[model samples]
Every structure is written in C-alpha cells, then in structure tokens.
Target: MNAEPEGLTGTIAIQVESDVVTSRQMVRKLTRQLMFSLVDQTKMITAASELSRNTLVYGGGGEMRWEIIERDSKWGLRLAFEDHGPGIPDVQLALTDGWTSGKGMGMGLSGSRRLVNEFELRTAVGEGTCVTITRWKS
Candidate 1:
C-alpha cells in the first residue's frame, strides 16, 4: 500500500462472529469511498473477513484497525489485526499455501497476502500476532 494512515478511519473488535461480519462491512464501505473497483472491493472484504476470523479463532479474539492512508497522490486502505493469543511458532510455514495449524484450508495467511499489494506479519510465541495488509487504489 502506498498510502500512510492519516486519521481514524475505523476500528472493529474480533471477539465473536458478528464482529467479523461487521469488519467486512466496514471495509467494504471504506473501499467504496476510496473508489476501489468491484474486484478490489471483493478482495478487500474477503481478506478482512479471513483475518477477522483468524483473530477470533486462533488468536482467541483480537482487534481490527482500519485506516484510509494517503501517500503522495495515491490512496489506499490499511488494516491491522492484533491479538495476544499464542503467537505463531513458524511464520514461514504458516505462510505456505494449504499449510494449516488447525482444521482449515490454510489460505488465511498466504491467500490474504496475495489478495493485497502489501503484507506484513509480526508474531512471537506466547506474545501475540499482528498482520497488516494494504491495497492501493488503482
């Protein structure tokens, strides 16, 4: 993502299933405001949904932070999901497609990374996890 978050764009807590849904809705609205294409909107919503679910389940719930960033003349949406659950033991293995730590298809990490222009994952055992991703408006 090219944009730098400037203001309070939005925020959602991933404590339950409903919050995950709300997170998707909020991102959809933000993407629309940024004039994201339909495809991009879908990608963003899907990515948000996946991250939110991950937080609720594996991370034992967390928070989702959204920001409408601006860089130079470009605009983008940035999302940061944080949790203090059992941090990922092997970040690299987790990023491998179809490699799951639990009962899942294992796309939550790698797939989400591919759906956006930028992806960053920070995790430590017993510490927490934070995954930030961004998609610039094209």
Candidate 2:
C-alpha cells in the first residue's frame, strides 16, 4: 500500500465527495474497456463507489489505485483503496452486515466485498487500512 502496487494504471484521490463520483466514473470506463457485461459493470462501479466513499469518510481521505490485469487468458480490474487514517480495530465487526460505526447504511464494506470476485482488507490499529478488490471479466 505504500510503494504503490505494481502495474497501477491510474489513481484518484478521495478527498471530497466529488472524488467518489469520479472514482465510479473511472471504474465504469475501465469496465467498459474490458468489455464487461452491463450487470458486471454496475456491480464494479457500485463497489468502487462504496469503497471510495469509505476511503473518504472512514479513512479520512485516501487514494484509489487501479490496474488492468490478466490471468489465464482472462482480463480483470483491480482496485485498491488506501488510507492513512486511524485504522480499523475489528475487521470482523466491520465486515458484518448491518454494522456501522457512523451514520452510514452499514453495508459499504460487506456489500462491496460481495460485489467483487476477490476482496482483501489489511489494517493496523494506529497505522492505516487498505482494501483491494478485483472483478474478473467473463
């Protein structure tokens, strides 16, 4: 999360609300470029929006890094939301549906994970957090 993951295609700072919207747009463009279906595009965009918002609100502003990757002749989009704010203390509690630390709808993290093909969360108390998600193009 510190050295900027290899093969980063782009990055968007999550400092303001507009940045979240921008992140969604970027993800949409990549999804379309990868020829993902309409439903898959929506899922990736929604997950990007939620995670980007979390990077802003919960992480107190961060950056969303993206990459286009390939595996076994299949293409995929990988996104990482990294932040340096106070890290999450309870990963399980945070991932539980209907559990929220603030006024959110309590589905950001869990829902985002459900929308993606792969989800990874790394956090350290007093350090920071990084959430990486990937969706393969079928």
Candidate 3:
C-alpha cells in the first residue's frame, strides 16, 4: 500500500495478540526514522501503539502502513491501519472514551485521534475498519 506525500514508507502485518507489545516496538523503531523531536516522536509512537493494539484485539488481525510526506514545505508522517474482522457498528459510540465492545480501556480510538494532526476512520458492521492518522512537523 502507498501513503501519500511520500518520503519514507513501510508496512507491517500483525496478528491477534493479547498485548501487541511487538507492534508498539515496531512503531517506535519506524518513527525514529522520521527525525521528529523527542516529544513529537513519543506522541506519535504512543498513538500508533494504541491503534495497533485496538486492531489486534478488536479486528482479530490487521496491518499498518506508514509514510513520511512533504507538502508545501511541510513534512509529516501518515499511518493507515486496516483490519478485516467484525466491524464496528457505531463509529461514534466506539470513538467515545470508556465505551468498549471488549475488555479494552476504550481510549484507543479517541486517544489516538487526539495525538495526531489528522485522523480519519471508516468502519461498518461487517465490512471492516480503516483508520488513518497523520502527525505533521511543527
């Protein structure tokens, strides 16, 4: 898969796991290449970790696509996570913190949304879910 505004791009496939600790580690490794400030990279890594866990737990399995983009002299990173499991029936409800379908903390979606500069999510009952997040250089 291709992420727009391309600079550096990569993809990772993850399986259903309890903690998704490996996925979070991978995000941190990839984010390091972005050359972001320490604080910014930390936030991006945190968001990516949270979303990866969500996909693994809720969607059964999924993949994350990462890319660095440059637009109008601005640089940023973009992530697209896709999964093919029982989809979310109500996006709004799912986005609400503390609202979970499983034994999750329910902050995955909302917290991730807040951590990035741009966020978009698409989900359906059986169609699956796709979440895109972007963090730009300040």
Candidate 4:
C-alpha cells in the first residue's frame, strides 16, 4: 500500500492479493460500512466488487480507497481503485461492454460504470489505471 497522509477522515483502505475472491470480500465489507440507502448500497457494492476484481486480475495488484461524503441528510460513498499494470491501450474500446484486452467476459468496466452515480477513469499505455466511482443516497 502507498503511504497516505494523516487525518484522512472517513477513509478506509484495503489491500488484497491479486485474486478475485479476496477482492470481492474487501469491497463487500466496505460497502456494508457505508451509510447509504439499501438500493444504492447494493449497486455500489456490486460495482466496487467488479472493479476490484479487474484491478487484481488485469493490473497485477492494487489498492482501494473509500471515503464517506455527507451533506445534510444525504450520504454517499466515493471509491478509487488504482493499479500499476499494463495500462489500457485503447480506453474507448475498453469502455465498450463487449470489448476486452484479456479473456474476461468484458462486462466489468461498463457494468460498473452503469451502477455508479459518478464515474471517472484515467489510464495510459505504460502508466497505470485509476478508476473512481461515486454513489449517492437519494
């Protein structure tokens, strides 16, 4: 895990071996701690699990950062997954549901994007990939 600065409130970080089962468990634990509506929590958990698996399988190994956001009575969760592996060469095609660089079913990225309220991805051929997902309570 990278060194994080002090006093990062409402933040949780977890590192899992480059394995899908462990990654999914990590995401499930985090999602359970988030104070979101039932539906939103389920959606975000599924998305986070998928992204976590992708990071482990495709990006060698990575870490996930989770933060809680609260505004008035509304609450949300923000998750960021960063990986240092063979970066995506063509992001556009990768975003397409049926397209994949590996032997994956090719639904991870696009499916996760659809489940989140806000999604952002950054990647380069040699550089790593960073995926940020936010889900808000409604």
Candidate 5:
C-alpha cells in the first residue's frame, strides 16, 4: 500500500448481478488508465467482480468505492465493497478456502486476497461487511 494520499476515483452501486459486471468493467477501465499490464488489469477486474457479487448476494446490496493511489512513483487501484446485509458470524471461517455459507465455491474472500497487493475485511455479526483490495501496477 502507498503512504501517499489516495484520490477517490469512482463508485459503483452494487444492487444486482449486473452491477457486478459494471464493477468489473469500471475496474478494468481504471487499471488500463493507470497503464497497468493486461494481467494486472485482469486481476483487479476479477477481484472486483467477486467482491461486488458478494456485496449484492450476501450483503443484500451495497456499493463499491475505488481510488487511484500512488506509492513512490508507481500507481495502484484500490477497491472497497460494502454491504449492510447480515455480516459473517465467523470471519475466520468465511476466509478459509472452500468454506462458504452459500452456493458459491467459497473463493470470494480468500481468492480475492491472493489476487491483490493488499486485502482487508471488516464485518459485524448483525450489521454488515466490507472488503477492501488493492492492486499495484507492475
């Protein structure tokens, strides 16, 4: 993550499955604007897609916030997915591989973590959940 101040780039409302696709497209566009390689762009887009889906499906709808960050001379894209739905009862279990409470493959959180440069998860049992991820251009 960068020590420099981050500038909010955009936000996408995630209320439906189509919003997940929109999030991915927006992230891909941002990554390309930052001159990220194709692989990096794909990684961010994939992570955004998964997180956005989680927000809509599990969180019952929320939003995705994005920022353009600078660290040293390099650029990065940061995304945060938030929802006010029922939060995970066990954060640790939710993060484990192949552990899902829904029909998903249980790769949304853990897999997104592996695809980005930074990963963060915040949740309250009855409140909601927020997952943040960052991918630095290489």
Candidate 6:
C-alpha cells in the first residue's frame, strides 16, 4: 500500500455504493480529528465523495487509502484512489471544467484539485488510473 510511514489513518475499498458513503464519513472524521474547520471538513468530504464515486462508476471500482502526513510543521490528510478500468484518454481535456466522460459535472478532478493542497493523477491507456490528494491543516 502507498503510505505515509508515520501516520497511517486507514484504507477503504471503493467497490460499491456504500464505499463512497463510508469514504466521506472517514474523511470527515479524520479532518475533524486533525482540527480542520467545518468548511475544510466539508470540502474534504465532498472531494472524497466525488473521487470515490468516480472510482466506482467510471473506473469500475477500486480502493481509497488515506494517511496522515506532516509537512513544514503542519499536518495533513492524504487520500489515494486507484482503479484498473480503461484509463482516461485525455487528461488535459478531462481537467477542463464541464468536460464529462460520464454523467458527472466533470468537477470531480478539477474541483477536488481546488479543495486540496496537493493533487496528482496518473493514468495510461488500458493500464489504470490513480489519484492522490492531500489537504493540510494550519
């Protein structure tokens, strides 16, 4: 598992509908524990909900793994979602606002990127896709 050696929080499978709900709950709880404000908590939960859904609906299901990390004397939560479905054909266009591969608002990637301090997406045709995002607490 991709990890933050010091502060592993937990990991959840993004294989079904329930997983998305569970992921949001997990992110909310973790964000709160890290002393994140309600607004930040909402943003984190929303991002997790969207990404977990994308993992299920678009990526044919995968996993969401999270960990706590410390950088520059500040703590943060890191989440990673992975899937083995058909990879995104055009990541650049995908990041564009309103671009939808499915029925989504196409906000999953771009919106989530905005909600976090760090965002990274990796994909390849016929290979798979993985997204990692981190939200920091000041």
The better candidate by TM-score, 1 or 6, is: 1
Tell me which of candidates 4 and 6 scores higher on lDDT.
6
Q: Candidates' TM-scores?
A: 0.93, 0.93, 0.87, 0.79, 0.92, 0.92
What lDDT score goes with residue 65 in model 4?
Answer: 75
Prediction 5 global C-alpha lDDT: 0.88
Cα lDDT, all candidates:
0.90, 0.92, 0.81, 0.74, 0.88, 0.87
- TM-score between model 1 and native: 0.93
**Predicted candidate 4 versus true structure: per-residue lDDT over 1-138, tens digit per residue:** 122331223333334543456545545555555545577767887888788878877887677776767668666677888888888888888899888778988988999999998999999877789999988767
Task: For candidate 1, list the clashing residue pairs, or say none.
Answer: none
Across 1-138, the per-residue lDDT of candidate 6 in tens digits comes to: 232232566679988899899998888778877888888888889889989999999899999999888888988899999999998999999899899998889899999999888999999989889999999885
> In model 5, where do residues sit more than 4 Å from their true spots?
1-8
lDDT of candidate 3 at residue 89, scale 0 to 100: 91
Of 3 and 5, the candidate ahead on TM-score is 5
- Measured by lDDT, the strongest candidate is 2
What does candidate 2's lDDT look like per residue over 19-95, in tens digits?
99999988888888888999999999999999999999999999999999889998999999999999999999999
RMSD of 3: 4.2
> TM-score: which is higher, 4 or 5?
5
Q: Predictions ranked by TM-score, top down?
A: 2, 1, 5, 6, 3, 4
Q: For model 2, which pairs clash?
A: none
Give residue 15's error in model 3 in angstroms. 0.7
Report the C-alpha displacement of residue 58, candidate 5, in angstroms.
0.4
Clashes of 3: 1
Q: Give the alpha carbon lDDT tens digit for every residue of 89-124 in model 3.
A: 989999998898888888999999989999999888
Separately for all candidates shown, the number of backbone clashes (residues 3 or more apart, or on different chains) is 0, 0, 1, 0, 0, 0
Clashing pairs in 4: none
In model 3, the Cα lDDT at residue 82 comes to 87
